[model samples]
Target: MPDTRSGDRQMAPPRPRPKRSDAEDNRARIIDIARTAFAAAPDATLQSIAKAAGVGQGTMYRHFPSREALLLAVYRTDVEALVEVAPSLLDAHEPLDALRLWFGRLAAYGRIKHGASQAMEAATRADLKSQYYPPVVAALDQLLTACKDAGHLRPGADADEVLLLVSFLWRAESGPDWQERTDRMLGIVVDGLRTAPRA
Candidate 1:
């Protein structure tokens, strides 16, 4: 004795969202572990890295395809991470401060990616830089413009010129004394970029 109208009133349960593929998760884990290992020692053995990443040789191979491929992926990931943070950086601080902070993060990113990035072929490296530099420069340009408009920087301040000076930041990633050297250099550059009286 079910009600005759019960069928009309019934509704289907909602469908569940699709889960992320396990292969993608495993690939991400491998890249993360490889980054740490490569940072600690640029020449760290792949066997050890695989072990540290908790993935089998076959799995790591399947994900990365090759060591060079893995290195390139890590480089791309680092650059993209820096690029992604630009707006947030500007939002969380004053214009000039945000510009300075972004460069500080830039120096750190150079260090993080330097080991493997330096291994890329000259032409390929140049291409990647060309592709990546525009977005970062665009963000920096906006920040610099804001600083000038706010009287925190000289009128006609050139973000491109300032960015050129930071090109050497990648080299600061090298050597045991890099921390002290990079801090002092970045400070000097930032100070020089400030308007008289931070007007």
Candidate 2:
């Protein structure tokens, strides 16, 4: 055995280090900035986003190799936030009210998706829809079921149909009055789901 132990140790791969807290904070700040930038303009540049985030181009590229990567990351973050808020909202409010509030957040996310989707490749968009649709629908279903169980919503109210009804959030043209219009439209949809007036 001619230094067999040393050779075995050299052949072992080094373990990867977990990301530092500072690095994670920087990444989160970049995503937040990029989300706002992309919602304002679909073609916002990566350099501009990095500058706005107070990070160097090197740091930006280290976290996200390209514009598409950053966009995807931002979308992923938004989706996760949307899903995670449903339970808390339900706990804090009546089911119908919770559903309405969750939909408000969903509408905001729709605005971001509308702006960002234009810059994404068709395949990437399709992939994102496939990956994210289930969890979103599941969250909606949870809220809808809560409302139904409480007799606040009609038994026949379907989550998929409700989602379809609100699809206009992303499809509608953006203008000064867009928020008012969407809010009114969402109210109509929520009202339609009600079974009867609460005593």
Candidate 3:
């Protein structure tokens, strides 16, 4: 009986330690600075970003480990934010309005992606797209389905096709008037997706 009881007992797995508050703050600061630095200059050095962030090189390295790591973190943060806001937008507004608001966020993310892509290698860019594309499409689908259910959008509005139609976001030249141009283009696309009223 003693032998059987001993064998039945098992050790619990060790819990991972939470990051210290200061470390979390430093990491967040570094990413915030890196996003601006990279956007302004695609080849901005890690040392400069650390300095701009007011963190030492050692702290930056501990958090990001490499330039590519920092870039990915920034892009991933943007994507997560973009996806996370969809539900809240839908909760706060009508379905079509929520979709339009989400597109505005997507346009902002496209700007960040345009700049970050210049610094990433071809394989790295491909990997980012694969990892991020699904969640983005899913978020869009959520909004689109809500719109269709509410009869605010055409019944056949497919998320994938809608995303494809908006692909010009990243392709359009980011000049001084880029925001205005993209906004106009997005409005056109949204209008096209709207359900036509019965005569």
Candidate 4:
């Protein structure tokens, strides 16, 4: 029986620890580089992004296997930023005012993301659905629920429908008349929602 208990169990192999912060930082750098390239030229290719980012093309490939993957990454970053800041909007001077404020930001996000999406499509990727849609939609649903609960929005109005309308309108081309036209459209929408039957 001498040392029998100790011999019974074999030693387990060491597990690899994840480099959470380093991986996060590298991801951040890649996204920042991609964003800078896109801002300068929305059609920047992977090679261009690699050159701008000071990383090798292989590195970029490692981080984002395909152009669509990069596009999805960028879109997710923007949505994360939007979703992260949403809570502060809840403390606005008024609930409707907060809704309007967030909607404006959402419109701006729509414009930026649309530009990125066009680039991704041109990159020859087939998948059109964003990888970030589910989370973003869920976050917006929360906001919509808050407004409905407060009786500031139409009870039966679908948040998804409203989001689609805003996204569609946000794509209207920019011009001297565009801002005013958009404002009028948004105003009409708000009015319609506010006046609709609560139940």
- Candidate maximizing TM-score: 2
What value of lDDT does candidate 2 attain over all alpha carbons?
A: 0.89
For candidate 3, lDDT tens digit of each residue in 1-199?
Answer: 4555766878679999999999999998888888888777888899999989999889988998888888888988988999899999999999989999999989887877777677866316456677878988999999999999998899888988999999888777678998899999998899888897433
Candidate 1 lDDT score at position 37: 72
Give the root-mean-square deviation of each candidate in angstroms: 5.4, 3.5, 3.4, 4.6
Which number leads on lDDT? 2
Candidate 2: tens digits of C-alpha lDDT, residues 1-199 = 5566765666668789999999999999999999999988898999999999999999999999989889888988999999999999999999989999999999999888887778865316457777878889999999999999998999998878888889998887778897898899898888888897334
In candidate 3 the C-alpha lDDT for residue 23 amounts to: 99
Better of 3 and 4 by lDDT: 3
For residue 27, give model 2's deviation from the true position in Å.
Answer: 0.5
Off by over 4 Å in 1: 1-22, 122-126, 197-199
TM-score of 1: 0.78
How far does residue 98 in candidate 3 sit from its true spot (Å)? 0.9
Pairs in clash, predicted candidate 3:
none
lDDT of 4 at 3: 60
Where is model 3 more than 4 Å wrong at Cα? 1-14, 122-126, 197-199
Model 3 TM: 0.87
**TM-score on alpha carbons, each prediction:** 0.78, 0.88, 0.87, 0.68
